[model samples]
Target: MKRTAAALAALSAIVLTSGLVPQAKAEEKKPYKIYLSNNFVGNDWRQQMLRIADTVVKKAPLAGRVDLKVENVETTTQAQINSLNNIIRTKPDAILIDVGSPTALNPTIEKACAAGILVITFDQVATADCAYKVESDWSMLPAVQAEWIAEKIGGKGKVFVDRGLAGAPISEQLQSGFEKVLKNYPGIEIVGYFNGNYALGPEQEGVASLLAAHPQVDAILTQGYGSGAIKALQDAGRPLVPVAGGGYNTASLVCAQTEGAQCILETNPAYLSAEALKLAVDILDGKEAKEKHVFVYGPFLSTDPQPSKLYPDVKMQKIEVGTNAFPDLAPGLSLPITPDWVEITPQEAAGS
Candidate 1:
């Protein structure tokens, strides 16, 4: 079985570049071909997802059992459709995709699955017929991270947000999460929310611009690339503002470890991917997979300096899971977690 799977992977890769054995003959083996369609490109988080996909492609214990192909095309609805159309043409045994929207991606996704292609989703997903999903509790965390920030700041101050892409679900969900928190504290005013577009240079520059615009910006809120925000804020010569955000990175963890920043709460999407892939393989092996979605529960919350500690639910004391995942305590910088705030710096978001 292992030999057959490996050969199939090699053969499938070859089939794409140069057709050998003819299409009819290639179909005879009915190989387990796997396609991974990643969402977004350029951001550290996106890169992390690709890194994990690469590791699985290279090192799955039954590597080559299926032909594994990967495509990362930034986060655009059209790109998603294009990948779907291409995968449909190939008619692979399975496709693992990171969705671009919860609602719009359904049509193409259903079309592929209706053609009998096995489908699974990671990162973000649509509401349609995904066989299963490997995702975190994204709908809840933005508020959780925000609530923490509000608590630390005593819920009374002006907060600026280095936001995410305008329409993406991550930006919306996390933004709402923070909004819910703000509702609890009427004293906290949102000064600005800039769509950072998940790029470090822009996110950082935006933070600098906001700092220049609002000298009294009490706290900065963001999701991904916040180092630039910190650099901008600190450069302006204000006392280091407390920051909070997410992503598992060495820089964020180092920030927490060094006590230079505030919070760096993050999720290990690799675990989510590993679990999701296991479900995909199980279906291939003719086992019962109970549901269409699976949620991985975790994120590193490194808060404050010496007072900061990992969440009680996830205590990784010696190894310290809360390391770079926090901002102010992240050895450097952080963000106030919000949904629409879709920028990040993933120095530690490892794939494998």
Candidate 2:
């Protein structure tokens, strides 16, 4: 699995020289083959992430130079490991995967690395030493959310914790971070904990059932189903409470419109898949990456006047503050990616 530095340096020179020379003088460039392996397509966020991965290769720099393939299977370690082994057999120049387990797929990933294939993992990553990882600040975001919720409720209240899908690395990290912060605020009582699964329908149903039994909740801390929590409260004929949520845009917009209902939005964008694609392409082209791991932080948006400097281009439809919430969009819409990060155009988004 280990690549000799001298061999890598020689290949780097060839790639750089090929790019610099005139088309007529340059050697005929063969299209670099890449494969994307997704563990599941359970939610809207997953669907969007796959779309962005497919769309990125059809654009500039990679347009005519890369042949990309995509595959999805059940979210199981064995399933993903099988997929990785098969992809390695195909001998693609690179493979990008959203893994199902942190350590289960490491040995398989090493096999691919030993075959001289560049591997990059995003979303949920493998523990392979050879693979590069690209993801957001999973730890900081949830901790920030927990701290904000505690402060909003005066450090003491009955709070409902809406967790994401079980067994997911990101979900575990977010939950751990949230729990760590809650420990500091002993006055804040966690009345109930439920897994929303990060989808709208299931989340709404779970919140509804919880509301029926415990209607006196003061605040709700949701992983990625804020809109569902809002709808659950509305259906129960109960007033809205201060909630920390992410992913969906409608909940934040609705919160802005409703009087005295405080909300904060921080979504992990699907476009990060495109960034993963870019990183893979760069490495295959023999461009040495400065860092093996990259951490992108999701921008925070709230109903209050947020820091104007962080998100300069972010235009809010109702609150007139931060990014992530758009009232102009229909209900159940995911937060739109920044124009600078558009791998797919508006036409593709509409068609998808």
Candidate 3:
């Protein structure tokens, strides 16, 4: 009887030990090596990019199952091309390139793919081929901004575009959207000129030259900070110009509150990163996807009668892009599309 009881106890212990070992092995998942290639680092957008990297690392289900290698190559196209080439030699499982032109980066992407490395795109999308594409429809910003302006300016005004670079995708797509909206309201006269250098100096100079070209500029519509237009307006004693921009941010919040600018729209960038990371992980996990262009999302729209309310403490503007456009994810590092704007009202400016 004593031997039988001892044997039963030993058998139970063995089963328990075996179960725990498998559990421990499952918990101690292997790490995944992911390479991230960043194209531009000096802009406000890039700050969000870094935040996205951090968010993905913290939020991914695989957690320790993934490792990151990040590299930024200023804004030079050649630098991006070279840096990506070098990273490819390391043969990471996946790489995300925040690019400006898809075609220019296509050859390199092809080589990386040939090496069995999955590639994805974010931010300034390259014209190159990749496994996934994540970003807001850049083509939509121009029309979206124009739509907001048309609503504000009552569908008729002489507006000048402080656009992005002449032929750049951002500039081109935004311009196309704006043009589409313009056709709807022929009363809205486009006082053309000004490129989005995405730099303060070029942005400012572009607006300055624009003011010179079109003295009767009713309102200035731009892509970046819109600092140039504002400076030109203020320096020239131009009372107020109703301007709308996509990169609506804290400074824009301050400027809007002080009646420096008008409507500012912000599309949260973290969503882009999270989406890009999600896809990258999927590809790494040996899953097969049918398409390459995987669009994550864009911004949310927040409108406060007084843009000043955002001063001191800013929060994500709840965008009304509809709930159906989202995917299911757990709490914590969940990225929401808060791409809305709080317009500095005409009354606010009038008082200022």
lDDT of 1 by residue, 195-268 (tens): 77766667777787877788697777777645556667667877666675555344355444544566545443
Number of the predicted model whose lDDT against the real structure is largest: 2
Put down candidate 2 lDDT per residue, 24-51, tens digits, no spaces.
5355667789888999888877877777
lDDT of 1: 0.64
The stretch of ten residues in a row with the least summed lDDT in candidate 2 is 308-317
Instruction: Tell me the deviation in Å of residue 2 in model 3.
Output: 11
TM-score of model 2 vs. true structure: 0.85
Per-residue lDDT for 259-330 in model 3, tens only?
535654545354466567667877777788766776544443334322222122223353222231122221
Candidate 1, number of clashes: 52
Model 2 residue 205 lDDT score: 86
| Residue 301 lDDT (model 1) | 51
| Steric clash pairs (candidate 2) | none
**1 or 3, which is superior by lDDT?**
1
